[model samples]
Target: MALKYVEEYRDGTLARDLVKKIHSVSKKKLRLMEVCGTHTTSIFRHGIRSVLPKGITLLSGPGCPVCVTAQKDIDAFVAFARVKNVIVTTFGDLMKVPGSSSSLTKEKACGADVRIVYSVFDAVNIARENKDKEVVFCGVGFETTIPTIAAGILMGIEGKLDNFSIYSANKLTPPALAALMETDGVQIDGFILPGHVSVITGTDAYRGTFEKYDIPSVIAGFEPIDILQAILLLIQQNEAGKPALENAYPRAVSHAGNVKAKQIMNQVFEVCNASWRGIGQIPSSGMELKKEYQRFDAAIKFAMDMPDVPEPKGCACGQILMGLKTPEECVLYKKKCTPMNPVGPCMVSSEGSCAAFYRYS
Candidate 1:
């Protein structure tokens, strides 16, 4: 029965029917952007682009957390790794991401105590075990992860783990969407919003951006059927000359989203201006620890102020993230950059659009 439920969404017949509907209705030259890295991976993995009409072009957005992490933030994480008696814990995807001068992977090779952790709780546990050493978790994510990081901080407080801190490069999704709409030369007819983020923020999180831009948006799950249905919806909305914020992944997402998770997140963090790897600073697009939780902030605790640096020359990661260029269009994509050796964060992250394009395209 479980197998049946999973297979139904991947059913070839159902997918084919949806593809046919998309091709039939997609008459205009609509350039839709998928605002989640998972959606980009699912689209490429399932060959959703190949099935869709040529008129409907799907562009990847600044959705991957690691991909969009500012260069200075990466530098800060690297700097943290170099500090004396400091153990830098981060998600595995961030290991190879090049900072201004170094990366955690390189620092680890040079005897820096850099550890890859699956969860923020794991980092907290590491701090608990090594009370003598300072454990700084590289906090990089969206609404989907902020709550867990918040919970981990609360755990630290309960245990009185003074050795633990988090360098939050956390970003919010809605403001970034608005920034994209305001940027010149960015042509997006609709948005295929992130499913995982929507599960936490609910459909209501996007209402402000939706109302401001009045762009056709749909929250979609990371499945072939889900993506195809989202594409069809976007095409339908464009063809009808009507724009609406719709939730196609209603199974996991709701109007209010996960209230408890949001409340927990709000308890620990507050909004701030956050910089993006490719995109510049967007107002109130970042989350930092609150004044009461300032003790848990690695940036404030260490007084590490990393300067804004230029990205690697000839790397179109910023342009690519903004949907101005595809991976193939980048000069360093297959030549100077590969998954084995990434010049930019976009190629290093698992859900990165460049990685997806390289793996599948």
Candidate 2:
């Protein structure tokens, strides 16, 4: 069959067949976690929860870029936006993530210039259009999105776009995944590894997760079939008392990953201590623009101070992000922390567990 865009991946009949197989193979109660924001959104978008058997439980994790983004960073973005001749451009989800006592949305209402972007390229274009304004892009996402961000930087450099900059908050996947697994919080029987992220980082990057913890890790696609098949593979592993790494999305992901992109990443950034809103500080999970590209580093350009921002009083976003609690567990999730007036980032970002739960649950 020929490949297309969205429809090529989302095969509904195949998904149903796989779901039936998952039900047949899964004997014991299998609690699986999908550690990708895209997967979370797909699960909700496709009504995946309703189709699943009662014996299987799917949990959310710290996968969403906006959800995992530390409040201090959002504050820093707000700070930059407030500066004269600076316009903050970011993905829509970031506008509402609470920072200090306020958010970018609140700041926008109070007249701190903030604009939404579909991609880093869009932000760059906006900078060119508004040459007098210092357009600082709020760079947030996992490996899947970082390549484009890096490409944008090179484009900026090539074009000599002096008005453009990036407040990079890009994070690594395996390190954060390991941190979640290390704690005695959630009992994740197996992991439906993020397929998009796996395409960039590869199956080799996650070999340690399987080897270290005897955890079955399967790189899964966003399609319902892919998710069900991954669960079946995991269940088979668990039943046989064997833990291993598998890739269900081989069409996109290879064992080795994208070498050229990794090279660009290595050249541009280095590992550093990263703060996840709920997951706390995971060592060497974040990327900082290297000294060679210090001129492009927004943090250095603006002299941004990352203060310890507190989570909202009644919000359980932290607990939700850890998979220790659901969005429903949070008193503020649907009430105070909603998409319209999101008290937390999770509720704002569609990929975020809270947003998924709020939208479909």
lDDT per model, in order? 0.93, 0.84
Clashing pairs in 1: none
After TM-score superposition, the amount by which residue 183's alpha carbon in candidate 1 deviates from its true location, in angstroms, is: 0.2
What are the candidates' C-alpha RMSDs? 1.3, 1.9
Candidate 2 overall lDDT versus native: 0.84
Best by TM-score: 1
Q: Taking the tens digit of each residue's C-alpha lDDT, what string does model 2 give over 54-136?
A: 97888888888998888888889889878998999998878878787778888889888899989999988998889888989
Cα deviation at 68, candidate 2, in Å, is 0.5
Candidate 2, which ten residues in sequence have the lowest lDDT sum? 2-11
lDDT of candidate 1 over 1-361, digit per residue (tens): 3554456778899999998888778789989999899888888888888888888889999999999999999999999999999999999999999998889999999999999999999999999999999999999999999999999999999999999999999999999999999999999999999999999999999999999989999999887888899989999999999999999999899999999999999999999999999788899999999999999999999999999998899999988888999899999998999999899888999889999999998
On a 0 to 1 TM-score scale, where does candidate 1 land against the true structure? Answer: 0.98
